[model samples]
Target: MASAFQAKGLQYWVSELAQAVLPILPGSAVEIRRLLEHPDTSLNQIGDLVAQDPVLRLHVLRACNNQFAEKAAGTLSNPHHCVSMLGMDNISALVDSLKPDCGANNRFEPRYLQAIIQSSHAAELALSWLPFRHQGNADQLVLACLLYGVPDWAMWRVASNEARMIDALVQQQRVPVEEAELAVLGCQRAELAKALAQHWHFSDQVCGAIHGAPIPSPAFLMRYARLAQKHSNDAASVRMPNKTEAGLLAHSQGFTVHLSNTLAQQSARSWYSKPTLRCQAIVAAYLDQPLVRILELTKSVALETSRRFAIVGVQSPAEGLLWPQPSAQRRRIKPSQMDAAVTKMASMLGQGSVPAKAPKSATPAPPSQRPDPLNQPRAIGIKSEKLPDGLDHHAIRSAPKPAAKPAAVFPGFVSAEKYADYETLINKLLHQPSAFSSEQEALRSITDCLYRCTELERVVVAVLNPERSKLEAYYAQGCSEAPALQRFTVQLQPPNLFTQLLRQPAATWISRERQQQIEGVIPGQFRQASQCEDFFLMSVFNQQGAYGLFYADRGLTDRIGLSEAEYKIFKSTGAHCSKYLMALQP
Candidate 1:
């Protein structure tokens, strides 16, 4: 049987290659993501991983100590220093690209090793023939020609037979791969390589190198091929100026060069992994597990690719120069790099743990079993302490005691004369500033709401925190004391808390923290305390959606012990505020 590596077809082969190589790369993506559940995994552990890989460790240091980060003024000598300066995610991404799994080794079989080497040599020659600026892509073109014969093995082909055909074309026929494929197998190796390259997720450039017209200048090919073949005898420190020369043939066709027999022999002896016919070593380990679990492992790699490739951009103004200075950092990778990611993501669904046509119900348990407690936290103490009769779990946190009668403000302020204007002010803040649009308008609107609303005195309005999934203070007028605002800010989900309650249309729903927050409200929007507050969450909402205002007080005004009619008005007013608040969109 041919080795697993000799198989053709892009998706299947890439997936196989990826499975083979990902374990060698370390840091299975699943393991990386599981960190979301464990916040304590520090930068130290990650630094150690980088230190283990000589190439990656050096790159990490270079990037961190680069000109862009020079001003950060941190002395980072190693992976530990890397994590502290660059952050975990950033460091992980840098090391990820260096993995062997990233289409680093293109050729699958050792049978045509000589032909592959010679073809790669020819590609180098073609690159050298180009102008100085176009030399950079030589590595890409060389790898392209090396694997040019791959597409032909797409169907099942016996390994010994495949090896004989490759040898006949190269050692016997003494021809290049493109001719070798056609003369011996009746098709061009370039065509087969192109098909396989496309199948495996190779970039357009690589495919073009294998199949595109040969480089225009024979002299260039002669130079590049000679130098590339000499690469073995030359010092390891030497690197060709591929970037310089390849620039001239940016979009044009390039040709191949032949690797000397000696270099081909040396490379095969030093670099090749012994072929494993069945891939039984790794596949056997995986066979016992559910397919879903296997896919889970692969999905992590796909997710990593997406995150690495995701570019963040700032708007470049049209009125300015045609192209802005490349302020935005750009990291380029070939199209082939994505082939493995695509196949893994697509096929991973099939390998998932559960079948699509699962049984309707789980099989019954045996004679003895305990209920699963994963969903609920197990409390050690008295179950009786759960809650007393009327109060919900929200009230589990204690609310501030209402202030003394004279200090209380809501009772005197909520009177009919003052109520109408207060209602009008809140209604105005309920939406965007066209009728009221700017940030300044938002502030002004809130100021009016606090000024006119009676003893509910001071109120503060805050925006939702995008990163933290919570509300943050935007504007606050009548709030008093850091502790009061602090209590309100905790556990307040910007849209969710109110949306969930309002959907039920409960006439009076205490906030989940209502038990912990009542005395925090002060009359006429206390201005002194709201400034220091970190998370400013006001329960001020209009009828539409967002007028979420929380009134804080030191003492209970007569309004706290309101008439049923007055209480109903407060509730209805809150609903109205909700409607208006929801109208305010970013």
Candidate 2:
């Protein structure tokens, strides 16, 4: 089959592609097969396991979405829901039909495996970044990025030699990637991806992400332009988007997915690469945040990926920061490609013209005077303050960065203490100001009060960073059972529950009934990451306003619903903690 398909170009590959052209990780396949054999295997278990392997994840989503669409039902993007819809028999059959290469006895090709790992990293990065921009359809975005390299993966499975040649020409010979793909594969990788997407009947959004939207003919473009202009001129005239126009518009998300993929791949190579910096610059401009802040975020997401996924042979991006890889050479893009990228980015963001190029004869502006899009004004409700005539309070607060003190050791569980007199504990913590040495210690004591006085099993105090854009977990108690709470971080933009609370000093409790009522307002990510419902959140404010919040839950057990009395005490404790925080501000 390999010999028959050699250099057959895009159409042939699309038409003749084998059913199992994509390769799942050998280890994942074995584990999945083992689990499927078990009589009590749950859909959630399979979904969680399938999530680790991009190949299997795509298979499940594609199969479920296709099945649902055939019945005129909306498609399913959530993996667990997909698994449930397919049923156990269908999933078992699907797993059984995987290629011989998926057998655990077979070894993975290094380059092919690298591509899979990179795609996984990209998906994780995209999912982690949803709160910042597009919070809706988070799962769909992850699936899109994971499947971005489907064409390449399929080629690696069926045509390893051609794949090797393309990589060689691009990496070893330093040829432009598009030129290299054309020379070796008889078509660009993106074009092949687009063809395969169509052949498999992928959704237009995914199809757009695979190779961008299909290029419209000049006649089609002119007709659309005329319709748009006529509608703009006449309020009564309706500008309807036909099938072609809707398909074209659906692919705008492709650029965001592409940026995620670029960052994932380059960060794995080296954090300091020119391509990496360029990607970060683009993101910084989009988010209206400093380039340095974006760089820090890049590192943080890479660390999160490493913590989340445990793929073999692939080193964590954070590892490169410590023992720098000698082989991790920075790859520079050709000027032609770089210019095209900038122009495309400008047009995609609705900026019609490219940034004007500075003339060589012109004196270069100083870094301070130069136009930096990242340094633009903050979004509404996020204020920008000019530096005052005194010492910078922001700098003073951040200067004494210390290692996070470990979670305080508390006595063993006490009986019948649930919702007991918390007034004494709250008053003691409030009155004894000198009892705690640092701001974090004070917060930790108050967090422990919930565990000691209330039936709540988990408590976390997340403080705002200096920029006040995110709340990072500063202290926690009763979170040993749920480690996700320990690393809890919440972005304070894009108007989520956390952002709304930060608008002013406020306290809110989400009981089971309340969670159902406001489910739409609560971000899917916060639900997934916090891994709780029926929780308590009380905002703590300093003089500057909206410092942080206290989060508590009954743990995953949810055996006991949080009571109004406990909520009241939690609010009072948070209030005193806010006073302590403000007192230490100077």
Candidate 3:
């Protein structure tokens, strides 16, 4: 009887701790759960629902990856892939797993509920306007917007005291949330959220969006726009915008002003019916603002929004979007000290412990003492002083060179005849100037054709930025469902893989052996961002310097080899594109 009582007590304690740390799914997510319960629901339909809620999306992705990591051969990056991999049955099971008690009956503070509602509103705004501007998947925009303020929700759940303090600082001290978080906790909320997201194995694009990095993708831009609009405030400290103000601001930002205003009013009406002070404040503020003042606010708001979320700029620590490591101050606790452990965990969540500094050594090492053999120069083209007894030195010195090895062929490529037919189709498209209306259309069509003809898992077309310093992907196929491809970018600095490839006129296949040699030049974060293991890069150019490049890969597949014929065909496609580009020049 005593032992059973102790076990029951321990279970209760654990349940409390879980409630403190685990996030509650918002209303939209609960609705999605209901939809998932139905037998007729499709994976795409569930994916669409999951994409609109960040907390649900994160949970779904984590569950799917954890359950099917071996079968998928890799961690799934997008919700669509997760749904497709897990199927409707597994997805329903996942929803069941997350169906905890979350509603008005739960003891949640009004402020916490308000923040979630605001986040949902931001998602709704993105869903309404972002699809009109961007290509690729609309679901991406929804996910990005929903997750833009996830750090706040995370903090609210795990460390309510710190969350309250940050709110106090923002409201009373009139400081920005980021600044207040840094001043009080010595770490930014976004950084903490990014660390948690990484722990949950979120894609680099999601992490980057949370970190407010310049991703240049449409979803990233829409996320920034929604966040900027959500966080925009007036001199009077109003958190929500007036309907007229929202409409004008939306118009300035190239959205449909009337639709935006209608949505704003609808959200406002819903909030007004709620019994929250924050909701009342929004309605009151909207009533007080004049049209002239609202119009005046639009100019500064637009300028500030642009500056806060610029598409192109130098990368900073905030923009670096790296996964943070745990602080050295965090220590393991014994199981016996359950109460103390729980308290410590809560404190750690609320106030991130500062990392301890390393003690300095007695003295620094001299340059000569730190010699590296890999950096040392080696003698080349020098004849040896002695030869083996059986060796003929004259024959060895004057031996004819062996023939060059042929390029490797990719596995599962079509036969030579079929490949010829594919090439014929591509060449015909390239030669026909009237087939495409413009240079971009022609380039995009070629990439699409290559993706279809080659039957590769992924293909992308990246062009040099106007500065000729960075390569940014503008067109991609096969992997449009993946977020990484949509936001792929590479710098062309020296000693980098991209620079090495750009210097050569021919296409180069990145085998595993070669990938290791250039690992130093290619950062691990870049690899994570692209989420591709093996690929071939072919530069496209014509007389004027190299303008763009084609990247193809069988991403996340077991097939890892590229054949000589495949390489030739890949290079031939680029050559055809080059010829078409040359013909377009005046």
lDDT (C-alpha, whole model) for all candidates: 0.38, 0.65, 0.53
Q: Which candidate is the best by lDDT?
A: 2
Ranking by lDDT: 2, 3, 1
Q: How are the candidates ranked when ordered by TM-score, highest leading?
A: 2, 3, 1
TM-score to true structure, per model:
0.22, 0.47, 0.33
Clashes of each: 100, 0, 8
- Model 2, 102-145: lDDT tens per residue? 43442335556667777777887677656655634777677777
Candidate 2's C-alpha runs over 4 A off are: 1-7, 16-18, 99-108, 214-251, 315-319, 322-586
- Regarding lDDT, does 1 or 2 come out ahead? 2
For model 1, how many clashes? 100
Candidate with more favorable, higher TM-score: 2 or 3: 2
Give the clashing residue pairs of candidate 2, or none.
none
- Relative to the unseen true structure, what is the C-alpha lDDT of residue 15 in candidate 1, on a scale of 0 to 100? 39
Candidate 3: give the clashing pairs.
Answer: 408-562, 408-563, 408-564, 409-562, 409-563, 409-564, 410-562, 410-563
The whole-model C-alpha lDDT of candidate 2 against the native structure comes to 0.65
RMSD per model, one decimal: 30.4, 26.5, 28.8
